[model samples]
Target: MQHKNTIKLLFLAGITMLLASCANDDDTAFTPMEFTTPTYETNLELLLGDTLKLNQEILNLPENVQFKWTTEDTVLSILQNLEYIPKQAKTFALTFKATTNLDSISRTYQVKVNDPYDVYYRPKSSESSSLISQVLAYNPAPGQFINSSFGTPEDAQKLVGSTTNTISLGAWGGSILVGFDHTIENVADAKDFLVYGNAFNGLSEPGIVQVSFDTNGNGLADDTFYELRGSAHADAATLTNYTTTYTNPGMHADVPWLDSLNTAGSVVVNSYHPQNFYPLFITELEEVSYTGTRVFPVVSNSGFTNIAALEWGYVDNYDADYATYKGNLLDIDQAIDADGNSVNLRGIDFIRIYTGAQVNAGALGELSTEIRGIADFSMLE
Candidate 1:
């Protein structure tokens, strides 16, 4: 019996030892690897042709931790530090992993690489023309001048390389795209360019202006165009995504139109200038559609129909006679994206002007924006 008790006591002692060993093992279990840095930026921006360095010291990681960086399908680096040079302007998503014997941690970073501000900048020289070098596009809405003096693409081209020549961007939503021989720099607290228009004291046909830069170095205006925020941009009555579709009357008569707001109207033909109001250049389509911001015109029909101009920040608004006669001095600082958010542009390569009003004055005529010329303000004396 004493021998049996001894055996049981030994078995109990073995069980206690096993429990202690299990507790100790739980206390010393490995923890997941983590970054020691208090705060780190996950999004970064850099210019193309610039070096981006990632240091392990910033992570405050352990020396024994293994590091790996990968992007897309390829591994970029396996060292503790990574040095990257981007050859193209784009956004890169990089995944970084740190591993230990028992655990691993990973993080993803988005890096945006932009082209240098001056990469597409064309400096002014003796051969640089102050006026626009080319007319990239011309699409005029239905108006008195649609088939008369200013509807053809050639008429729009006449404004190119000359400041004295003018082209009427027919009624609402008519637009013309023009480019410069050199980039127009956005000087500090100064106007960058001028849009010439025939705005007088009582007559103001406002035009919305947009600008774009050749980010791809392709020398084309295929890049995104940012609108220049005018004073009326924030007005309660202003329609941001206004669209108008004009159905070809197919003859020399009033051009019928419908808008996004379910409103219908016509570009009334005046007896003074009688011609087809529909654009002759737009022969391919039975209906031409234009979408843009529309500003309500303040018209008074006392003895004569008169349209009042907004305060400022438009192409053809009557502000001062001197500035009106010369051209509308435009500042690049007023650029805004489609969401009406302000955009900071270093410079611009292309300029677009479009008619912003859709009012039909009694006998005076439909309000239309006109472009005489475009010039770099910095290049002028």
Candidate 2:
């Protein structure tokens, strides 16, 4: 009986030792370790003539990592042929994404080109209400907003002494937003030259033309900006008083205002308006109509908006018409093929329908800030 009790005691002791060993092994195995991503620093706001520098460093990262860079502005880039110039000052961004097996670090640099000196800009009215009056207040020496639809660049010269944008629209679509570049030897030459364009007949909807100024050289417009849109006003003749007033502040509003650019005149707007434009739709583009009232057809499957604001970059190699007048600007619609592939884009941001596109794809992101142009200050002027 004693021997049997001894065996039982020995077995109980063995069981206790096994339990302790299992508890200790479980405690020792529970060491939590993690990896940390790299760190980078860049100038959040850089002006023209400023050198863009990226101070990058890694922390607790494995070797043999990959580094890639991307940019929203085609004129500026890294490890690519695109040249960097601050002409037509706007906001642009560069993203550096470093990836490793364990972790990744992504950094962005916000660059502002062609920033204007305080004295150069005026306090204009809001964009939503009085587009024409606000734009005119900036340089109200003595000029008229000539519709390029009715006459030639010469006519603009005859009316305002300086031609604004090139003539793009026909007799109905109003004038292109172009200005003068020629000098007269005799002070009496053909008052204006002309700029022709393609997609004139192909466009089902009206086009957009924005007015810009090169404040700080660098060939970019960096200061306050105004937009002009000319849509077919069925009763434009009977309408004598046409005005628009943007009611937002800081260039963004919940209800989009800046989408519909009028063709010079046809529609009337007032100066009391604040800024109102769709941020995603930045380009003063010709509205293309495929089927009906909307510019683009809604995709049935992906739930994308039919009319989308396409992000365009410089096209130096383009051989189309108006290439000279348009310069290296991003000019066409960023459309995806039927096969569900994206267009070749230098840098595209928003993918939703702007106020003008006429289709509602859901809310895409706001367009890059560079395209917003400088805020209008002509009100103080």
Candidate 3:
């Protein structure tokens, strides 16, 4: 009996010790680890020639954990999962996988590519396969000077429309145009732009009128000029007074002696000034012919009656920033004379019509005012 009891006790002790060893083994563990993907925000839904960044944060892993990266076949790459770039574009499926210590996690990212000048050209018209197409509408560069080239940031904010007017007094069947260049550096789209021009031509009226740049930016009559008689006379320097008249087939762009002042085939833009030295030049052609005092009546909400057609005319002819005049044309048709003949349209382009006419509602006619902007068409090729 004693031997049996001793044997039984030895067996029980062996079982207890085995259980304790197993529990101790269970408590022994490898190093703990954790992982989390990085997070960031993109300023745009679509990216073009721009760059994107991926920000990540790691956690609870061995300080010496190894990192292996893989990416898609694309124009640009982060080479690692942190930042992947889709150089060109695609409705792409992209994935990123991270593996460490036998534990792996993955994520995906997507973005679209688009033109920055979308406001002016979206779903492009047949007229423009490029990023931007022709933009119409312009304002005289405040104090526009002659023989000089200059631009403003306001000139880059293009104007968009489904269609343009088929009729006008200046340039007919308006076809918008613009060019861009900058004087300073450090721009968002360096390939963006700096200068701008807008123009249109009306058939038989204002045949051609275009905004051009001299490019020197000095506000002096420098680069582009008209050779009149012999000397290269800059177009305009002051804005106090200005006039435009077409010259006959007489002058060329370079020669001056043969320059035609009248009865020729070139345009003469004359300007008056007091403080400025550079005159602004605008290319034009012949269109409408006129003789008798061409009257323009102005009408506006302000109840003024005896206003004359002048820029700095009446005291109450003021509004937000500048004075504007609009008129009801009692007559502006293709005039036929007493002989049943098209009043032989003589002057068919921009002409120096006297501005001393009477205003309708007031004395000066009502003017149409709008926020002027320019659109570039280089991308529409």
Best-matching candidate per lDDT? 1
lDDT of 1 at 183: 84
Provide TM-scores for the models: 0.74, 0.22, 0.27
Rank candidates, lDDT, best first: 1, 2, 3
Query: Candidate 1, residues 1-381: lDDT per residue as tens digits?
Result: 999999999999999999999899689755555566756799988877568898654343445788899999888899867898987789989888888666677778899998866466777788989898999998899888777776678889999878777788888999999998888889889988888887877788999999998766788888889999988898999998899999888887888999999999999988877777888786445889999999986888898888887777888778653253467888899999989888888899999999999988878778999878988988885
Better of 1 and 2 by lDDT: 1
lDDT of 2: 0.29
Model 3 C-alpha lDDT per residue in residues 49-163, reported as the tens digit of each score: 3455554455665544554434355423333334545455444544544455556555555556553322111222345322223332232211212122222223322333311
In model 3, the worst 10-residue window by lDDT is 226-235
TM value for model 3: 0.27
Off by over 4 Å in 3: 1-45, 72-81, 110-120, 123-272, 276-381
CA lDDT of each candidate? 0.84, 0.29, 0.27
Residue 163 shift from truth in candidate 2, angstroms: 12
